[model samples]
Target: MALGMNRDVFITCAVTGAGDTAGRSAKVPVTPEEIAAASIEAAEAGAAVAHIHVRDPVTKQGSRDLALYRETVRLIRASGVDVILNLTAGMGGDLTLGSVEAPLPPSAVGTDMVGATERLAHVAELLPEICTLDCGTMNFGEGDYVMTNTPAMLKAMAAQIKALGVRPEIEIFDTGHLVLAQWLEKQGLLDGPVLVQLCMGIPWGAPDDIGTLMAMVNNLPKDWIFSAFSIGRNQLPYAALAALAGGNVRVGLEDNLWLGKGVLASNGDLVAAAKTTLTSMGAKVLTAAETREKLQLKKRV
Candidate 1:
């Protein structure tokens, strides 16, 4: 097959995720202050966007506290860092079933389902330049946990996101998620500039293979913008793969914890590594300003 490489690319650093990864790596930022600092570091390291997920400073678990989101956004803007802020609006939809036999009632320990309005409370309050929209529901990972996002829920969130004038980074974990995104576009909920994040290599979702990646890329709307990343060791490698596939790149502790063998990574280290990889491939890493212009983002401070 012929190469359709993108000469110019922008990197998005997913600083931290809504997962139980803080204890696994000391570099994972938990507090709002730390999250903000990590984002600034990524911005300095050539990442045009900082994908943020706040954690409970006390429990070190992911949180959807509006105050935490507020403080984190405030600090990032106050530092005069110019990276486009992209907050995760994918929380509050977690579902952990009781068991294989008694699945009638969800497990109270891990299940966190809420209304669409509450799920996006942080986005409605913070008004970041870009926010995530998990495009479809899927069996997220192990055991009984399922990432639940029904069509009705997605439509409601997309409509509100459009009304708020915030760009939705449509997160496609599998091929079906991409189809759902197309459906959302057809429904006029995703009318404006569309951006997608192809999340690969997660168990029960899309695998991180070249052929699978290209298939997902080929299925995307020609005019839509996209970035791609895989978790773990494949994270940095995806920088080159994404650019080669005519897309952008994403990297950070949220997706991977290591800078090298036996070397834990900070968010900055991941972004720097991705930058070096993309640049080594002769791809020009775009700055924050250029990214904003390309995506037609509305900057709010």
Candidate 2:
């Protein structure tokens, strides 16, 4: 398989993930207003897509409340920001066990396993251009926290997302996740020009090493469009690597917080940094319209 760099790249800014980083960094947007503002900032700074996850304003914790999603999307649309929206459908699958020995009951703190329809309720309601579908389940990070996404659950979600006419951004956290994506494709769940996100550097999943990334990229379906991103400091560096590896780029405060040593970065800062890096490498950053056309995304108001 011959490999070449992607001259036309689109940046997806994951404004704020479902992680507990709101208190860790002041730059992290907690409220819907803040998230919308950050998304607008990222778009203005050069992000073609905004990957969003709403949080509870009071607790500053990730929430699956339709009201939050509605408010956040409402604010972004009202702002007239011309950016593709990619709402995360990976929230309700979180399963945090009680402990290694007593993992039956499951800890209520983080175990939010819901039905497939309930999980994609926001996607059905908001009808964003793109929504994430984590391809497989894995032990996510420290402790008994498992980012659960069973094949059955995934297939159901994919079918629903497809039926809603929304693009499902297949988020692959490990190599096996690619197999799951392939299975979903075989099952006729994923539509053509399939979108994938190689989420790297998350613990217990695919590492951020060059070799692992290439392996994942190599095994990707020939025609599937993909983006690569690594959490923490590698987020900026991976922007160049992703373009060089023939994929798009994703960078934001969700995957990373620091711009440099002791410098916290906002979503705009991260998007601008990635844009400069990609442009310096002689790559053209695609706008929202260009990305929509290329990915055949259905943009909603």
Candidate 3:
């Protein structure tokens, strides 16, 4: 068997996201307790890190409730698991437009726009090992809602991340988001060697295509550590694909819900599947400690 270009790669399990996906999958953890348990489980299943986002326990909708984040992080840390925790700094930026004609007043129903500082409230308070910074804003899903992040907003948030000594996982949804991440690095807002997560296959963002993945990878800084994943059925395939492209891999219930056809997946199941795929390709899956060193992350007490 030919050795893969990258022989070692780390897997990040996104436990849950700030998307309305809980309704579709019964296994998606909704409360603080469930999220923490799921995170620890993923770590045991061979994920180097757990990417997290909390939701309203009652409605099962994505939430930015500060208390919820604090409790979730607390539970995970208290679990004595060695997994690296990556909380979402990607919340509080949803912009749902009421209508195209009357875009004057943005829809209040699902829109959670706030100033940059307020958006990082949970991140600042919890100070996890890593946090995500959506490098650019774009239309998110089928709704009029957009994932709102401007350069100015990103700069402000990045500054706080620097001050707090947390690493920012620059999320590149499309090619241009990578450009914005590059600009942020040049401006000294980001620390090196940078960490980036290529979010592909979302509507209005980069398509989940090999050409697109290589193009994005080609443009990244040589020293930067990057991971790539596609949503839905493409999730598992992208695990090996990313390693082949010389990047790490991300997979979890947040981005996908099934381990195989007709098989609903837990966070651990998705992570275990990714580990199996990467190892089969002659790559040694990295542990959480190795991942922390690779990313040069600062641990918060």
Candidate 4:
């Protein structure tokens, strides 16, 4: 691996996340149509890839419905924007334990858990160029909710995703997650030039500090292709840091909601802002075609 940085960097815009953020702002797209439209706008603004997750139209809550995923994929493709479609395989793993004392029949309503195959069902059908594989589990926030994914589950999910020919972008939330990811690589579940996304600054996860980011990056395999993002205000700064560290950048409403304090942002605004930051630092943004080539991604249909 060369220490020299590649001037061409790929930008990925995460359209909407599976969080309880829709109600926070009307700008957050709920329906498939709005999500797809936001994605197209981001692509036009400068993102080469659009990472997606669907929501139930009525409740505006995150959902793993196969039909909704299919519709979103179709709409983005039909838009003819040339952006790579990257679907979320990170849903259906929420586990909200009952009041610390009686945690057995885990809060039935909001807690959704299934086998690895079930989680990847939409990914198998849609066959997007890239799909997320969260490397480990962690206590998310102050709630009793725990994102659960055991080693067996990750291995099973990795094998299934590899079999489907979809590149798994290992989502590493902490240093230990990177250890597990490297183990997966050694087991031959993840191929060479593995793609990774360093998800930083989430509560109870990796901190958004520079030392932590560098530690995570130094541990990655030399030949791996990587990207990094931080939540909230650090989002834009991480873009420049990722470029300087020889990796890609991911931005959009998923990790942030505002372009500035009191300023609501659309997907395009985030991607365009990232582009401006990267280019100002002497880095060239990659087009969809260029990104496909750099990441060795196959075109879908």
* Model 1, span 58-157: residue lDDT tens: 9999888999999999999999989899999899989999999999699998899998899989898889999999999999667999999999999999
lDDT at 164, model 1: 91
Query: What is the C-alpha local distance difference test score of each model?
Result: 0.92, 0.94, 0.89, 0.91
**Model 3 misses residue 99 by how many Å?**
0.6
TM-score of 4: 0.97
In model 3, how many backbone clashes occur? Answer: 0
lDDT of 3 at 46: 99
Checking candidate 3 for backbone clashes, the offending pairs are none
Question: Which ranges of candidate 4 are over 4 A from the true structure?
Answer: 1-6
Best by lDDT: 2
TM-score of 3: 0.97
Clashes within 3 Å, all models in order: 0, 0, 0, 0
Q: Looking at model 4, which ten-residue stretch has the lowest summed lDDT?
A: 1-10
lDDT per residue as tens, model 4, 230-280: 999999989998887778999999889999999999999999999999998
List where candidate 3 sits over 4 angstroms from the true fold: 1-4
State the lDDT of candidate 2 residue by residue for 156-236, as single tens digits: 899999999999999999999999999999989998899999999999999999999999999987899999999998999
Per-residue lDDT tens digits for candidate 3, residues 17-88, read 877789889899999999999999999999989999999999998888999999999998988889998988
- lDDT agreement of model 1 with the native: 0.92
What is the model-wide C-alpha lDDT for candidate 4? 0.91
TM-score rank, highest first? Answer: 2, 1, 4, 3
Model 1 spans with C-alpha error above 4 angstroms: 1-3
